[model samples]
Target: MENKNLVDDCLFCKIIRGEVPSYTVFENDDVKAFLDISQVNPGHTLMIPKKHITNLFDYTKEDVQRYLQYIPEIANAIKKAFPNVTGMNITTNNGKSANQVVMHSHIHFIPRFKGDGLKLMTRNNADQYDEAKYNEVADKIKAQF
Candidate 1:
């Protein structure tokens, strides 16, 4: 059996280990999603890679393929369950530095509406520098690729 978490005592790992229970939404060979009991919004859901990586950057190619495959279906299921929902936000936090409470590779499908708990995060644009600066940065990134 898998060790489940990168380190033992991980709550999400316990869920995978069946040492604890979660209100699961979907489970397949490589992924699992469950209802967020502490729902940010109704039907709030969480999905995770079955392997014991801590975040997205650690996912192997096969792990990534399997992880991506379930996202659309998971999103569709949540949307279907709450037809009144206006929009959806899929978010993942990477590290403790990023405020990721659980040290496991997981994504969240947070439902959004006109006014709700999920809308707590505000969006703001970063200041755009001159066009020359933008082009220089973009060119450097393109070169790296």
Candidate 2:
């Protein structure tokens, strides 16, 4: 059953409704998995909830739990479908500052190989970090929680 509360102009919502074509991998009551059109790598896949959600912060506890519960299963299936996938990166960006182009929340499963030339992360100004700075940052975050 399609979600009736989908956003009118959300691209992912359109894909979910079959208004746009997608290489679907899996679908269940609350989520859907499909191949990413850009293919960050050959086996790059995107998983999203059936209900339209703007970002991680917008999800309720139950929504977060239900949406994420299918990740391990879908990730393992992707690994099996793609040969020589020694490692994988599962990532989701939140707001615009984080480079989240689509408003809808979605997780990307990117298959990795030895020397695939894809750098998931990079060190920046590591030597500039001091213990006091780290403690201050941690304290601020903990205060909010």
Candidate 3:
């Protein structure tokens, strides 16, 4: 099945087209999973849609369903493959400001162990928001739905 969303010059698109090599771990019609070259941890894997949608904001409901369905199975396989893994981080950055360097929408599955020293999402500003502030923000987001 040809991916209608393929972007000609995108690195991931090249990988998908076999124009570039990748350490591919999983692939189906709609998605591909591969080892991240910059392995933050030993088994860091990336899962990307075969479609070249740039980020979360670009995904349609059908795109989400098609691309996200493989996550759990892949995560479980990563955990099982690395016996020392005690937990994992499943995350995606939506834009350049959020550290999305590739521009192709992808999810990172980084296998974690104790003292892995990978500090993620450390800055917490929970105390800055009171109940009313929380409710106000929630209402604004809920309105979009």
Candidate 4:
């Protein structure tokens, strides 16, 4: 049974409706932020718009504005929740190709400490550098600045 009122079985919608359970931290009229079941660290959190959208790229201007309006407070909540955190990283996964398991627009705030589990490595190879592409990317980013 497809419940049109529920955005076609959205996990976040079920969470908001209390039809499912989650370790939620904050919620308002238009947004909600919750603890990740698979925590990347002590304060890894997922924030989302109350309304359904496949991802951030698909949000309307109103939805975008509404979601951003609440971010600072939500971030502050994370800061308080993870009192020992040294730094924070905010990220969003867009599509299945981008690793988004749930079809909802969400921002993840992952806090990090010195020598924590968020280490990264890069392969040094021919695919790592491209000169023509670098200039084009810099030109595009410069325009934004």
Identify the candidate with maximal lDDT: 3
Among all windows of 10 consecutive residues in model 1, the one with the lowest summed lDDT is 117-126
> How big is the positional error of residue 52 in model 4, measured in Å on the Cα after superposition?
0.5
Q: Write the per-residue lDDT of candidate 1 for residues 1-145, one digit (tens) a residue.
A: 6653345677887788777899999998778799987788898899977677888878778877877788889998898998888889998889997778888888989887766654355665447677888899899999985
What is the RMSD, in Å, between candidate 1 and the native fold over all Cα?
2.4
Q: For all the candidates, what are their Cα RMSDs to the real structure?
A: 2.4, 1.4, 1.3, 4.0
Summarize candidate 4's per-residue lDDT along 32-112 as a digit string, tens digits: 889988888887889977778789878778778877787778778888877777888888889998889998888888888
Between prediction 2 and prediction 3, the one with superior TM-score is 3
Clashes by residue pair, model 3 = none
* Clashing residue pairs in candidate 4 (N, C-alpha, C atoms within 3 angstroms): none
The digit string of per-residue lDDT tens for model 2 on 1-145 reads 6568698899999988999999999998789899998998887999999999998999999998889999999989989988789899999999999889999999999999877899877578858889999899899999997
Q: What residue runs in model 3 are displaced by over 4 Å at the alpha carbon?
A: none
lDDT of 3 by residue, 1-145 (tens): 5667798889999899988999999998889999999999998999999989899999999998989999999999999999999999999999999999998999999999999998887687899999999999999999998
Report the poorest 10 consecutive residues by lDDT, candidate 2: 120-129
Question: For model 1, what is the C-alpha lDDT against the true structure?
Answer: 0.82
Candidate 1 lDDT for residue 35 = 92
TM-score of each: 0.84, 0.93, 0.94, 0.80
Error of 3 at 136 (Å): 1.5
Clashing pairs counted in every model: 0, 0, 0, 0
Between candidates 1 and 4, the lDDT winner:
1
TM-score-wise, the better of 2 and 4 is 2
Against the reference, the lDDT scores of all candidates come to 0.82, 0.91, 0.93, 0.80
